[model samples]
Target chain A: MSIGQETVLEANEARVVYNEDSDNPVEAVRSISLDLRKGEVLALVGPSGCGKTTLFNAIAGLIPLQGGRVSVGGIEVEKASGHVGYMLQKDLLLPWRSVIDNVTLGLEVRGKPKGEAKKIAQELIERYGLGGFEHSKPSGLSGGMRQRVALMRTLAFEPEVILLDEPFSALDFQTRILLQSDVKRIIREEGKSVILITHDIGEAISMANRIVVLTNRPATVKTVHEVPWGDEVTDPVAVRDRPEYQEMFSTIWQELELTNGQQGKTMKGAA
Target chain B: MAMATDIGEAKKQTAAPPAPKRRPRNSTGRLRIMAYQVAVLIAIVAVWQIGLWTGTLKPYVYGTPWGVMQAFAEQIANGTLLRHFWVTGQEVIIGFVIGCSLGSLCGLMLWLSPLWAKILHPYMIALNGVPKIALAPLIIVWFGLGMESKIAIAAIITFIVAFLQAYKGTQEVDQDLIRLMKSLGATQWQTFRKIVMPGSVPWIVSALRLNVGFALIGAVVGEYISAEEGLGYMVYYAGQLYDLDSVWVGIFSLMFMALILEAVVARIEKMLDMEK
Candidate 1:
């Protein structure tokens, strides 16, 4: 990963099953085992409704793991509260709060002093391009601006690892590409480890150091691809031009198609 | 990195055309509406005046507008109308505040326990269905014939509506926001304070609007049962004495009071909208 050999996050055969005690239990995540190195961007790309969110929730400790362990910095996720900051696809900004207030939400919930939290949040706002819009409410901002505030909110808490769940899936293409570049720069500058979840192969190829492909529901790791471009390549457009990006995209696309076909066969078998 | 340039470009593209301005409503259209309202009032007054002059209506029974105006002048001169106005105003305001506070507090507390909410749901619905005005006599008996009775009636009337509204608001707060709070390592109390309370504001404001009117009803009903002062007592006393003009004056005063309270609630709603 270029920064260190130390692992920041590890998911060892972590499994999640929904309605486990019910008559018909659904296995969402059968098994996922992966390690995220320090200062690395790892992307988990899977088909739609393929238990990606289930895995994300497990890592965030929002839900309990049915079996096995998901740990952050060697601490089990369930015990490691406030160690991982999570960003959802939707910005989920508090409409009543101003930009600065939303950014400091994590700190406020953490019971940090108001003045100290505001100072920390203020630096992030000014350092980013949202300096003048500190007092502006979320409704006044554009979609892209809201997402930026969401990122700032995640970053303000200074968690050991950040999890982004399809952070750009809501944006239009033009806004998405520009934001992708902006986010990459911000994460790189802060030297934060991130686990990005998306269904977009192009996004995974452009952003992550290592891309983990996942199968359909009861998701298991299909393949893991290491991007040839190193940390120096943060711009998505630049990454797309590289021969490696094109080659890796097709390979992942084929793997995903195979998983979808297998899922249909399994459904037929059940019926 | 072209971070600054990217932001500048993004701002330019996403700056959608300021929502079409609403045309300032056209002064002539506003003036026309005002003219129509005044014309309607003039027509009603003219019809009443003509009827009185032609002897189609008796002045004693169907009191003339001029007689009602004279009654208003007499009350103002003697200062009894103002005294009654102040008494009713105090009862309405005090009862509304108490009822809204206690009711909403109970309603919000219900959110802390689902089992309690389930247990109390049917009882709350049944209690609300019992016409509170019917309990005015009982309320008068319990709280006495003074302003306390009127205040008690007002509080009782408004309490249930406020309770129902605030409870519904607590239930309706976005579930995703709660999930977000949990992910942030927030305790249940923190989630309630930051997310649930603020999210419930729109519903609570609606309750305030509805309950202000309900509080007024309770106060008037309480005064109807037994009171020496208040517009309701004034109207009842005038009717007993066959003073039609004075009765009309009391009724108009009550209408004016309701309009003012409604405007205040509307102003609060506007302020909340702007803040959010």
Candidate 2:
């Protein structure tokens, strides 16, 4: 707890309940507290349908929490409107729009003048290896290219913290690894705080400086591990080759399996 | 020698198959289809002429091909057909403009206000369910036997088709895109303009294509009931007088007009890039 990192985002005892008053009310997240530090990538890893996404949504101010609070740069998150940059599992690029137009979407929504937005979008596109595709439609781009465009779009808005909800899950295995390093490098260069929600443990370990493992439904943080790889480990691919990678992977896997076993036992007892 | 033969056989098996032959050009296929259509039309006209010459068909009842052509020429020479064609064309154009605008506007309004849509849903269904041709008499009575009645009828018919198409299109827009826009801090109006309106362009164009036919139907139906001038009136007058050739001329003119309208709508759809 005394790692001496400056906190960029904090979620305190955050709780989320769906259909609060209905006959079959469901609690998705329960009293989860965590901190995201400046210039660090925090990955949330858990079982499927474990409310990791729900927590991400709460942190992004997309959904109202029943209790507790989420703050970015010490300011309370009231709503999603211009608060956090969010990337969903799908690219969600507008098909009718060209690549540059889609990238400038956030700026356009903010009412930035067209010329200024286009200039910024053009620079981002060229900077991120998406040059020569400024006018191509989203349909024409490959999956990895499209995701890069989406990332560039989020970056263009310059939010305090970025919430990535399984942004690489839809990509192929090779592309996922490549993008993992690419995104990590870009984010590190920008020096932005990010909270990545991922089901893939390898992805979590590869990209994140810290990982939070959570329990199934009504999810709570089961454990938090700080990645021990030092500053020399700049590339995600290089980090995977280190001798400590397998050990860390197995440790997190065991933690996940423990929760799975507990849930299985509970189901058996009920049946 | 046996080993060499086996190697050659293996290579033959592993080699890629020959590429399939390319199909004939699409333009050639289209030309062939057109030729067949023309032949069918010529054959039908030839049979009609032969039957008339053999006295097996009554020219007064079915009308000979030559007689129909003569009637067409006579009408053109006298300028009556041109006048009637102009009247019907005017009614259709005015009615299409009014109907398309109102339908698109109302459809957009309903999309923005679901409460209004729910309240008016049943009434819309009821209005659309009634055969618009049945309303011809009432329309003429209200708007009179002039071009006003024809235009009114055409407008109502076009309105129903256009409204339904636009409404469906608006409803079917990608929810994900809307959510993305909202997350970007877009206001409700900006979302509607940038996402909803552009998304519905295909539906609006399709509606325009369908409404062209509806507009023509409404105009002709209104003219059939009571009108001083129009192709429909000519048809009705010719039928009453047992001038079958003149009736055929009127029908052909309406068909030709419909084709032209459809082509114009298709061109507009292309310009809008609705196919993309």
Candidate 3:
């Protein structure tokens, strides 16, 4: 697979630690180094608190990196302006604002005068099957519809890179499967690079070209699998139903379960 | 978990049920509960009327239901009630608005600026502990015995409540949302306006309702210290004159206003939920 750019986002010797109340801090991620090429999808998967999120935070400049550096589109992570879009798990839409307003929030925040930003947001919403929902509140939406709005909101800024922090984790299996496909289609159609974080191996297998699995907290890259899922345009949900999909899921599941079972007790010592 | 399994088993046992060949049998039980409440209210009234009629209670100690209503009616007829109503109402409304706005602003500011939040958080905590009641006299001294004093006192009391709630609410914002905003290169202000403020609305509204009560208390207490007008003054003066009926009327009026504020706040809460 050819990435649009050589190094759209690259992290060198990145490490993160979390300190809570005491001098002793838990090293969540230990020295992760990876490159996210433009238009390619990289999936990060591991046990809970294995620093998948910490890596995302470090890359997004939400948290300071204890060690090493991150660069996005040749710019340092700290100065990565309008370079990344994030899709959170909860889809935290403003209750008082309509779908259009929620979708256009990033643009509005970035000072793209309301008229044009709103027009663009509306087009995206309708293009993504949320036309009638433009005026509806988050409460007026189904879980899937709300996620779509959340996706649109993130996309409003037209980021060079996208980070999806378990965007479909909160949905039921059926809706999760469906939204995964929509999300992939939307991203590919927009030609954006993506880094997806999830615990679901099946999800990583179906959505990402590269899957990086982390060990327990004080995590390092346990393994990075280059999954060659047949075609990019094929339906993700349909792929999940295929027997080949189950084989990948079973293999990935065992790998995760093995590492989790062995290293679960050592994380506390690391902390 | 067992219940879920039982439901699944039950679904398998029967594909469908007779359109609930039954309705709830608690209708009579609900009626009984309602009758019990009426009976209790009637018993309390009867005891009061009996005390008045038998001269078992002194007139100065407490006002009978009829006496209180009569005093309320008289106050209404003389147009005196309107003046006092305006005074107290003004203090409450102005204080509520000013206090809630300032508190919310301060809280949002604190949330946005961690340095300020750290600097002011402890000082604010100390202020919260300073007892606004004790500050009532100081407020009157500073702002004089006019409505401004009461308004100032009420606003201070209301502001603290809101500030605490909004601060805590802002802290509770989902990191996920913050990441989303940051990914889009939203400035700190934009993050607050787009993510933090909306997230804090429920908390702020709760503070507003709570502070409304505090505002009323502050205004009334401040009035009790010094005020030529307002229901607080009426109640205090009536107490000195040993006119319990007038006192009761003032108390009931304040209680009624509180209920109205509560209803308004509740309506807002419901509206927010529905919108969400």
For each candidate, report its DockQ versus the true two-chain complex. Answer: 0.57, 0.34, 0.44
Clash pairs of candidate 1?
none
Deviation (Å) of B210 in candidate 1 = 1.1
lDDT of 3 by residue, A160-253 (tens): 7888999998999999989998988888788778999998888898888788887777778888877655345357766677776777787778
Task: Residues B34-139, candidate 3: write the lDDT tens digits.
Answer: 8999999889878988998899987669788889889989999998887998899999999999999998888777877777766665566566566667778888
Instruction: Tell me the tens digit of each residue's lDDT in model 2 across A173-256.
Output: 999989999999899888888899998888898888899999988999999998898445868888889888899999999999
* TM-score of chain A by itself in each prediction: 0.97, 0.96, 0.91
Give fnat (model 1): 0.62
Best-matching candidate per DockQ: 1
Ranking by lDDT: 1, 2, 3
CA lDDT of each prediction against the hidden true structure: 0.87, 0.84, 0.80
- TM-score of the A chain in candidate 3: the value is 0.91
Of the two candidates 2 and 3, the one with more favorable lDDT, higher being better, is: 2
- Comparing 1 and 2 by DockQ, which wins? 1
Residues A1-271 of candidate 1 have per-residue lDDT tens digits of 3556899999999999999999999999999999999989999998899999989888888888999998898888883267888888899999899999999999999999999999999999999999999999999999999999999999999999999999999999999999999998899889899999998899999999999999888899999999987777889989999998889999999999999899889989999
